[model samples]
Target: MSEVIIRDDLEAMAESGLLSDYNRRRLTAARPTDGAMLALNINLTAICNLGCTYCFAKGGDYGRITGKLNEGADVESILQFVKQNAARGETVRFEFFGGEPMINFSTIEALCWRSEALGAEQGIRFLYRISTNLTMRLTERELELFARFRFTVSVSIDGSEATHDRNRPNKAGRGSFRAILDNCYKVRERSDDITLVARMTYVPHPDSSLVADVEALYAFNIFDWFQILPATVSRELVRTVFADAFGDLAYSEICRLCADKVDSEYKLLGEIYMLLFRPGNRFRGVLEIETVIRMLLEGEVANGHCSGGRNYFTFSPDHSIMPCHRLVGEAEFRVGAFGGTIDGEAVAPWRLGINDTPVCRDCAIRYICGGGCKQENFVATADINRPDPEKCRFQFRLVHCAIQAIAESDAAFRARRRGVLRDLFVSCGRPTLSSGRSEEVPAPDRLTHLIPLLHAFD
Candidate 1:
């Protein structure tokens, strides 16, 4: 029988997988990062509308974000960063993120104008994007600016009104669902490129309600795709609607439930290219994300999804740069700031990828889970080595349920969606395609859900 392994020994085993010195030297010699990476998130204001308890900024605490807001990064400060990056021959893409980036629309506009002029002067086209709460008022001129500047907006919507209002209530404890829907219509009216990224924070009890939950968001014309975030409840947040589900089920279960009902969309989105992201429909939402997963492990990621701890940094409007947005407030967690550059030697080491953390270093699942969520690690203070095993359970469950869903569906639709997902993931498994140019990946239809894991078993 295979020997029963323990966590400590598993860590040693993980390190054992590291390349031999000779190979290490060779891979390092490749000068891996070919050119300057594209894009940087310039967070204009830390202020936000609805203050979710787990918000990385630890919102509403002026002390938490000592940095000033309501102020734009002077045209000079932003211009300097852009020119320097452009000089390095890297095309610049500006992303405006904030407590509610819309709150700082004034600053975003300033940056947009400057970015356009700068992009033209340098002969580099600037890419723009925004993530907002939608309830905040936005003007036609603002919509026009996005159209003119070509801002790809992702408005956060949490599933149906009950689910949304339940978890994402406003400061006054009223539901913000209808407000978001209203804004979404205006956005769709402006352009099809506007993406409504529905975010569902799961509370454990609603398994049966999953399908309707997903379908409700689909009713919103602009909800191009959905993003599923594990619902969080600090002790203080327990009084709200999602309080019980916080750590009740594994993340794998969350994924499985998601996969079962809306697996195609949620699972596929997780695997898309981080940089130059484009939504895929050729992928009927069934695509497996192996290539994308492998790509992230290989250190290629965009939009902060696979930060691997270095490419991007999250600042609490005050400028305390945490490794990324995922792990914002924990005291032990803060890395550096807008006031300081991360230590070159340490940045790579501090990266959350490559089984670097102690928990990951010893984990048998590190290759698959990759130290789990970077922020979740912050949630596990004393024992980051003990990854939130709940997530593992959730992933596995999502796969099982999604496959079941496919089984239950009309064979024809399932086959088509599965085929699309299969083709996309199959290509990703190939080293050539998975490791191809990192700028942007042409998305095929979302492929068969869970094909990536099925491939693993095979």
Candidate 2:
């Protein structure tokens, strides 16, 4: 079993300051209800300026932007989808995704205003969020709108100037760190209280500089939290650069090494525990904890093919619905279109385990791994009916390592505390040598209270 160090101090650490007053109020008012929790992923736009190699959306010239596909989704379609989602009494969270949501700032702003109006009339609490690549083009007003709506803005950068530029370079093939930093500084200069999440991808590397990179992000004082992801690509998704551009092993080790170094970092520790214990926590909700942590920190918790049974529904630019982001554009994976009424029945087939295939069925870690990446199946294998072995092996190893670490932490606490207490309790029975009526010495067997913590600790 791989060793994991889960500190005892974490449970007592302070709560996240990044958690908004609105969220606190919402969490306070409506606890985790069995009532539906729906996240409407509006791929508002697919046009982006940066030219990162592993962009899943194939960003920029390859796709559309804002509330519509290249065909454009009308206000009616978006409204209709929102209404149907609301009719179900779900806790609706609206998330803007794209090549760059800032590109479609007007649509996003309008949607917020419209959603506020409609939700107020309907009495639904509409929460907003967006995932973006921070760029200079975003206006001050747009940043204010995000703050006003409590829309958590999650931005991206690779890591440091060299690292970030090497992987997430611009179209001119130049490092974007300087431009990204300028944007980050502008946000902070405008609003110190604004909650910013910085997302960085983990590319394979021998020397782990992530801890240092995190410190540097801290130095800039822009990001409130840091998000890490293993830059993902599927050879089958697109033939152009998949084989030549997708290999990065250091990202995986960065995560493993990060677990070791950040064990005591107060904020990440809470996320780690949530990823470990809570099924619904944003960090663990992706079905695979490690992968989801990166996504959660990036403010995109994908209720993938694995979590479709849980509580989520995704809408592409066209408002055609799917189980998760990865299923977009793939005809067979579409649960149902948002063009008409959203029939609960039409979307039922994509629920967890329903689409699970042969490799998953035989694998021991299927449930924890959720039969591996659904995106991989779509882009890597070209078959929703199959599980990608590489994906499965990766997740299985990660989950197994996570579980083992949890167990070892459990074992260490017990073994040490038990030994200490056992000695203390046993010493209480160490009678004087002169008082030797030495009863039938109930042997060293009856020390019950001393080891009682074994139950709860384990």
Candidate 3:
């Protein structure tokens, strides 16, 4: 694994007033008051066809007994919930999620049509997105509905065939790579209007190579964008499946193993940096890299880890509501029900900004890191406010890479690619200077000094 050198100079710059001008402004920026875009992750079913090794949802049932959403009552409750929360002319995003949401395709169809009708009546615009494995064949009607709704399809395929097959196998222990690929092509052939995102999960195994996996996936040239995320494996989940293999292993050891996987991301970062030089490079903007770059370019900082527990809430198949989809099985995270009132106090902790976390407040890259993922933090440390040290190290490295990319890129290159880069950022759901600002704000002068320190990594 690559090591990040936390130089004293960089720490000093953050602690003192040198970097505070920009950092403080970002730290103090008001959080969005009125929730403009309310994202509701409707967990259609707890049942999935595939049994992933690192499945946090515990074989698609979220560690609970198998259950699926009721197309009738559940659909009605969801629509009612939206009506209560959203205002007229406001946009409500229904993100179809599950073990494999395709298991409840009927529910999806019903909800989409019903929600569209409701939107028309109430003057509320509704948007749709689905996170599916793409192992199932979609009917002509399903394809038409997706194309008409312009649904953003996030397909969960882990890079290459070898990696994907190993990480995600069917219940019968068979490879699903071929089926998923065929379905991907089918969906792509259906419509150019639908946005297809290749969501790759990086599992830390001895045989796994992140760079090779990404290259194989990119070669297909089927996806419009790529979202790569590290697999979050809890000790309980590991013990449940591989107790005999990991019986004597400590939780700390498992965390160490996963933390080491950050090196793969570091390697991929180098690939992304190189792609910047290639004109019309489709693979240049990975979601992770583009997010940091977007923040740097727009002078924006995250008030929290994500919209979870705030505007973003997950509705489980059992009618329970949780702060995040990852915390679906946990009872403590449950703040409300489908048609019940949400407990504001229960969700407040997740609303904490980066400046609010004591551990993150002193970090050099606190503003950029946004205290890491709250769910990851809660899983690792059993506390939402505290962050995993290794995760913190990874964030620091990522932020440094973003700074290096901006500092090293020539003015001519930046000027030529500014428009393209802006579009990439916006597509990733981040607002740029075009949102309100008339002119782009130049990065702080102190950022230049860190470029020399960043060279140590090279």
Global lDDT of each candidate = 0.48, 0.49, 0.70
Q: Please give the ranking of all candidate structures by lDDT, highest first, separated by commas.
A: 3, 2, 1
For candidate 1, give the lDDT.
Answer: 0.48
Query: Mind giving the per-residue lDDT tens digits that candidate 3 earns over 1-458?
Result: 11223354455545443343444444456553221267788888888889888888877877773587888998998899888888897878888899888888889999999999999999998878898988887778778988998887888999888788878889899999999898788888999877787888877664567778877888877787777777777665665443345456687886676577666566565556645445443444566655666565544555555667767788887789887888887888899987898898898897776566788878766655657777888877899889989878777766666666766677653343433332222222322211122133322344434533221110
lDDT of 1 by residue, 1-458 (tens): 12333343334333443212222222233322221243456555656668653454455342345333444444455566456545533455555666667766777778778777776777776667676777877679787887787666656666788777766677777888888888777876887555444545555344435445656665554554454554543444444444545357665454355334443434443333221122443112312233233323233221112333344445456555555554445456566655455555534544423333554445433333334554454464544334555555544443443444434445443333222111121211111112232223222233233222221110
Poorest 10 consecutive residues of model 2 by lDDT?
Answer: 427-436
TM-score of each: 0.66, 0.62, 0.83
**Candidate 2 lDDT tens digits, 224-323:** 5555545554433322333333246353443454334333232242334333332332121111233322221222211223434234556666556766
- For candidate 2, the lDDT comes to 0.49
